[model samples]
Target: MNDQYQALYQTFRWLVPTQFNIAEACCHRWASSSPDARRIAIYYEDESGNREVWTFARLAEAANQLANGLVKMGVGRGDRVGVVLGQRPETVVAHMAIYSVGGVVLPLSAQFGPEALESRLCDSETRVAIVDHASSANLLAVSDNCPALQQIIGIGFADERVLPWRSLLARQPNEFKAVQTRSADPAILLYSSDASGAPKGALLPHSVLIGNLPGFVASQDWFPKPADVFWSPADWASTGGIMGALLPTLYFGHPIVGTRGRFSVERAFELLERYQVTNTFLAPSVVKMMMKAVPEPRHRYQLALRSIMSSGESVGETVFEWCQSALGVTPNEMFGQTEMNYVVGNSNKRWPARPGSMGRPYPGHNVAVLNEDGVPAAAGETGEIAVNRQDAHGYPDPVMFLGYWRNEAATQAKFKGDWCLTGDLASVDGDGYFWHAGRADDVFKSAGHRIGPGEIESCLIGHPAVANAAVVPKPDTERGALVKAYVVLTPEFAHRDRNDILENLQEHVRERLAPYEYPKEIEFVDELPMTTNGKIQRGVLRLREEERAQAPAANTDVGAPLVAPAQQPET
Candidate 1:
């Protein structure tokens, strides 16, 4: 390990619960341990269909080559490099390459189109981009427009002008000088979902994430023994998937299982059994789908699963109970968001599980239920969840991000005196654990995505037939909330076939967005209920969805709009 890494490892020992750098720990484990310990694989049986594996030794070597290749291509300390790859072994290598050089990693979705890719690249002023062979074209399309994108490398396909990954060993220098990076240096940048305006990059230092590991391990039961396999269904584009699962895996030599295709309850179980995954992080909405879509009782196939951890939304009470009873894996639900990061969790280790508690705040961290005025709320009073900034422990050392990349004004506004204001509303009971209330604004969860209802409604209103629109999350077991849009169509849209119109919009959006982001359903109404000022009442629409979903009978209404072949949006 470099001096910088050694210093950090020591710092964590004294200050952080996990006393070692995850990257160094993984490298030493892979090099010195038995060959069996080095065995790791990324299962992709969904689309390509089969078992493909990579040995730890092989991955370590490949990552070394990729790391050197990144350096040779002029990537080094403090530089920003964007990665666009599928959930395969190479994805992990890309992370290693960037970190080894002390460069910051910016992981984007392989599914982002040219336009979305351009937006992120420009905003961060990324220096290098590594894309999957399939997405190289998108990078090339945006590269010229993004002057700061110095080099574009491909993971799978390589040309004479474009370097292929296989040549990293042959063309690049084998000897590399790994930068001894510091705790405060920017190590990762994740762009938040754009709800208010443009997406803002969340810049995080290595120390910020490293500090959360002890609590994470305790809560998720991630350590002591290396889990046989680890997985997180969240996309690499999002920060949760990387920090909450991927980075932690590097702390221990554990193989991870991830699917390159859409998440299926059956496929997830199959992968778990195939890889013998012992610990995992998932969105609870996935839990609902597993029970609904699987053909038979899965407990027989789930012996490999020992821990089921979740976040991005609350662990609905029903799903929490079912997981313990059915899968033999109790749900470890955590609560917090991109701003204040890790606040509370069942700590994954706490048992006799509380009905609604997200567990207590970790040691060194101080949490309080603050009223609208930022003062501590009275006992049993619901208030905005706030993080104490000046506690003797100092934000628990590592459970915080550096700051939002460039939005200094927004940052200052959210912090009131010494507390980091979590816009999330919650309440603390007499016992000290926090209970989640609804969001403070329009942002909500549906189908595992932190969706912006306005974005969906905007697309609906674009159709010539739609004049006004309102969208809301209808709670469902499979996906905590399902997107249900209510639209007031223009007369021209009514003339078109309903089925035809829905089909066209879905196709249009599929072409315009990442696949997981598409809404599951859409509905049309004569007029959206609104206030006197004409602002659509989203709360009222949300209630409408709740009432209909709870009707005392079967809810067979699957209202997906259809489109005629003539006007179907191109994908």
Candidate 2:
């Protein structure tokens, strides 16, 4: 290693193994840490509490076998290997294997129906597809559609046509010639939003990812010892997942505890207590659910937890304080996205925890807030977030993605000259701390005043009767757009009268916010429509609100207040 690398190892001495590739990391842990250190157990409840574990040596062998399997199926360097498994271990192995042998891993969401999954496979020209048995039927239905798929593997039952995961592992070479790939070679392919339109693929290189690793490593508190158990609920398709679930643990020598099934607060509590889980990763929504579901007062249970951190979702001041006082651990928050990995983060006991701020950029990243035209935004001003790339500096972002996969037009559009445009809108405080706003597209004009839905939604969620909320603008003649809120009421308030509840929520909002920002209409719903990744489907909510806005009004309503029935109370 060079002087720079040595300095990093010293700086992040707490993060162990210090390997570039997952395969190598596994091999090192297996060979030196003893047979026990290499074993990873995944606790899955949905499949009849079915549990499975894989040893490091065993996984290294399996990865080699899978790479050979891909090679036999005509996959090669720069080729795309698509995975369609649910939140399962096979997906993890497949990603490492594909990249270990110089292919790119294109992960398809298990939540995807045949249509979405097939579109991605065809778009990526995937040569090999590994699907969970649950999704096999859907895959077969769409098999004839993807012209480039040459082979298929199943994670469940074996078949004459499709190889099972176990069978592939049984016939392994136990070794692979490490591909001497440049840091610039593509390794992962990720998709953008689907409901908004056609999803775009963002391609990332190994070196780009390496550059960004320092930022992620710099902020992690509590040296991740081999005895540590790490868990994260974020999916593999997202950067937060890769950073929290895979990168920190694998690179730092920490034992990770993961579930292949869905995440639950009850399960979270159970696993933490049962396994002595020391470190955990979860979204703010999950944390909120945990706070809501637990029967005892906040932070009542002690689970030997040293730290709990989160990303992708924001944690509130109350939630942050509750965790610290209840569990004896303060929650750390990190910030980053699909384009850049962990650009900024907070670590427990080291970095000062801000109640609501996401904190400054990681020690290694060259990050800045830029105005509409790309000049740096003044402190305390909102602007687009951008990263400056300077190759000469050793402290460059190694984990930035290559570009939008094969979509030059889209990639070119995002680049305002040299800076990588993060569509997220944010404001930097005078202290250099960053505050997240709603997405740029999510901002809308209401009564000629610009509004961000996140602020309204945040206010609604603070209500005692509200559980979760999503706000969108509906078309209106007088205001051009009207705010409509779809809410999930707290369990205790579920049986309340709709009008009474609406009145309470409306009055509450009007008192808390400006008249224009208050929802013109409030709709009680069982649950907010959310993406597979757990983000609210605001577009869907917007469409529902628009339909309600277009609904015909009664003849008597003609002289009534302009608020449509969709918004205004009955005359």
Candidate 3:
């Protein structure tokens, strides 16, 4: 609502052309117009401490060569290409090449299991896949099941059916004519899990990249410059990791720090100190993990971090307070969904952030809290978060998703009228800042009282003894469902198994929230189930609880290690 915000939005709206291609605009244009030939585009570090860097000219050439190779291999405009590699130089190059050739990108997360990978590969009808040793076996397992999949390009691994990365690059020309794409042409396919327990693909277009630029540029308190190094622990396959972090950072031509393997707290600290990362977008869970690992991190590491923005989950006030004092900057929290990224958030340049609020809606976005009838809810009334399809002049919101790929019915259900339902429960305050309650599915009722788990979970995590927390409804015969918490305690508190720990935590929530919202039963665990994007998988926890109830003999007080394989704490 400030002059600076209005100027930023107006500038971007005028600059972005009606037709766009991410690879061309972010890569080739820079390579041609400016002195970006030697500028580093990406700074990559493997888990073993090995490092590599790529420049804009080098990136452009690599992407061009790969695009030529894809064309030679029978790939054409609109073809689907899958990328299933870890965080490496090739991951970025593969994305660039796919976009250059006008092929839709299918970013298959390395964290996906065999069945999940197969489901996506088939659903997207991906013609080709690029993988490394870590994901080759999984790709091979599902290759035959994906009838449309014709080729596998290996980054490091080699086999009869696999094409070598170097060989393919060597055979192709280093000059490729960039394909022309309309603003609405599908460019990327990212799958997000829904209530049906199946992953639904959100097909995004070329305009999405340009549409995202304004919000990100305006949302950072200390806006990232070309020299700033950006990094994120979240999987690049997810919408948050791609549109929210990777592409937005790339738009500024800033160097991105790429990571592979598990997210080690020690390594994260090392990277921060070594790279002097000025701007970053991380999940709140990752920051909390750092605080739990080190009591006072401010005095421990010398960090040059200027701005820390978090999305994919609600950031608690406790995390914000710690960040302000420890990191020397109050973290900016972004509120968005997988379908539409970066809808609202705080940026000191635009407005002072209010603690516990999702900030005001970005200048160009028409967002509101809507009731069931699709009308904007009154201030303080919680309702489904929605975005208007068009503004007053009838220009469509470019950041909105095209639809759920291959699921027309699901796509139709996502829109109620002019507003696109986000399925998130929120309320707009008198100041126009939105306060997130919880997801519609995540909200539950207990004894005639509607309860949002986010409120209780935030209170539990605020306690010094608790490290990570998740709240779910436990089946109760008398009161439909009772609140239950699954928690991971800090190291100091983990050693003590006294009953008072549970009692104190229960009291902690009761004092901070309504009586009916307090957790009725608390379960301690080493870890909670999380998605690749660092969101707590409450559905999985709910399923596990239901299974335990149906068992012949179940432990009433459950406490055990629940870590998933290939799982690491990420933001």
Cα RMSD of all models vs. native, in order, equals 7.4, 11.5, 11.7
Tally clashes: model 1. Answer: 15
lDDT of 2 by residue, 276-348 (tens): 7777776666677777788353345458677777765467697788788767778878777677767766764
Query: Candidate 3: where is the Cα deviation over 4 Å?
Result: 1-15, 442-571
Q: Cα lDDT of all candidates, in order?
A: 0.67, 0.67, 0.78
lDDT of 3 by residue, 333-359 (tens): 787665777778888656777677887
Give the TM-scores of the predictions, in the order they appear.
0.83, 0.73, 0.78
Q: How well does candidate 2 match the true structure in TM-score terms?
A: 0.73
Candidates ranked by lDDT: 3, 1, 2
Q: Which candidate number maximizes lDDT?
A: 3
Error of 2 at 491 (Å): 38
- For 1-571, candidate 1 gives per-residue lDDT tens digits of 1112223223333254433233444453564467744566344443667556766666656667778888777888878999898677777777766777888888888887676688789989998887777678777777888879887777668654455666655676543545676666777888766444456677877675655565567557545365456877877666667766776665666666766776677777777777777888888777777766653446358557777768867777777777877776678777666654555776444433465567666544567879978898987798888887643344344556677878888778768887887767888877666788877666777655677765556656666667776667877766678766676668877667888877776665555456555566768656655555556667666765777778847654444442222332222
- The lDDT of model 2 is 0.67
For candidate 1, the TM-score is 0.83
